[model samples]
Target: MTDWAAHEGRCLIHLLPDVITLFHEYVQRNPSDPESGGILLGTVHGPHNQVVHATPPFPTDRRTRCSFDRGSEGHTEVADQFWRESSGIIRYIGEWHTHPEDYPSPSGIDLREWKISAAKRTDGRPVIGLIVGRKAIYIQSTSATGKALVYQALLGNCPALGH
Candidate 1:
């Protein structure tokens, strides 16, 4: 198992080996077609959130060649189950999705949605958004104060990012 740390000293988001494997499998399932996505579930430690698990694409999700609208159906139930199973340690930390591009960048709508989500969060912890592109994965952590820090994947097997 390996970990990736954000450049900014303020926040660190950990992507566990299983989570990484799941993301890669999801991307490989549909290399260049419709988008798929789900919520990020994990535990928050001071100044860091370790992403232990990520929900698979929901059955009700709306997918297209260029966009994905994650369905909320059964999401709350799944989250609640995770919370109970984890002894209330695991909770909704943020969101994640697949992008068709080789190196994905968040669209305007993505940023807007993330901002709104962050603002609405009552935990005061940053929300982590992940985009799994064909060649690489992008991660961003946005604080309740609206400060966002981009993270780089440190694992050698992961594709290198330009920015």
Candidate 2:
């Protein structure tokens, strides 16, 4: 067996169930329109790639008239509210949403979002994105960490994070 502890550097991840439940419920409630979105919170370690499938308990922001201009609106606002209203939880390590009857894999648009979000979290902290329906998640590592795009199987806690 491979000794996970023997690795040069290890990245640790913990899936927040409360968060995941919220995400699942959000997707189930809004499967088609605007999809959904939320924040990821976690700890970072050495230049390792780790993916965490977290649920967002925040509500979606449906304000504003324009769909394009609205952005993640209510959903993102919900995330912010959770952060603002919480007793004490780390800020979103990344974001996630549902993919209808599809797998939880990252898409081109998802990548673009990661690029922007990762740039914002330039402190070597990776952004974890989850495509909930198919029960999948993606880990987008920062360039400065000397790591490549890592994909892990979220059905269980296997943190291979392969490119």
Candidate 3:
């Protein structure tokens, strides 16, 4: 498990070990492996959030060495199902993709997409953007008002992150 904090500790994202393992499974380690990603599903608790599940890439998703475009099919249905099963507790919180670099950073396209997503949210909750790299993960949060912030991991000792 890892805790990521942003906005002067006003917001926190707790990534469960399972979620981390799921992401690590697609780290883009092979030269022929394309980028893979999916939707982030989690539960919100006041100012804190716990990421419990991540949808896997589907056949319809567009995957390239440097980019991943999530397909519409299978993604929404999974989110809906989780929402119903959890009594509206679990929801679509964010998106995540794998990067080839060891220390990944958000690209211009990524930032733009996140901003657009945040603008479309009607619940006033933040939208998260996650990039899993070969050795580290990058996370960003955008508020309903378009305020963006980067989160830092509380534990600087994760083996996968090479900390």
Q: For this target, which candidate reaches the highest TM-score against the unseen true structure? A: 3
**lDDT winner among the candidates?**
3
For residues 31-73, could you state the per-residue lDDT of candidate 1 as single tens digits?
Answer: 4568878888998888778888888887899988788898869
Candidate 3, residue 59: Cα displacement in angstroms equals 0.5
Q: What TM-score would you give candidate 2 relative to the actual structure?
A: 0.56
- Report the lDDT of model 2 for residue 59: 39
Of models 2 and 3, which has the larger lDDT? 3
Better structure of 1 and 2 per TM-score: 1
Question: Candidate 2 clash total?
Answer: 11
Per-candidate Cα lDDT values, in order, are: 0.79, 0.46, 0.87
Ranking by lDDT: 3, 1, 2
For candidate 2, lDDT tens digit of each residue in 39-78? 5554344533222334343334332211111244454554
State each model's C-alpha RMSD to the native.
3.2, 7.2, 1.8
Error of 2 at 67 (Å): 10
Error of 3 at 13 (Å): 0.7
In candidate 3, what are the lDDT values of residues 114-133, reduced to their tens digit? 88888887787879999998
Better of 1 and 3 by TM-score: 3
Model 2 residue 110 lDDT?
A: 66
Runs in model 3 with CA error above 4 Å?
Answer: 156-163
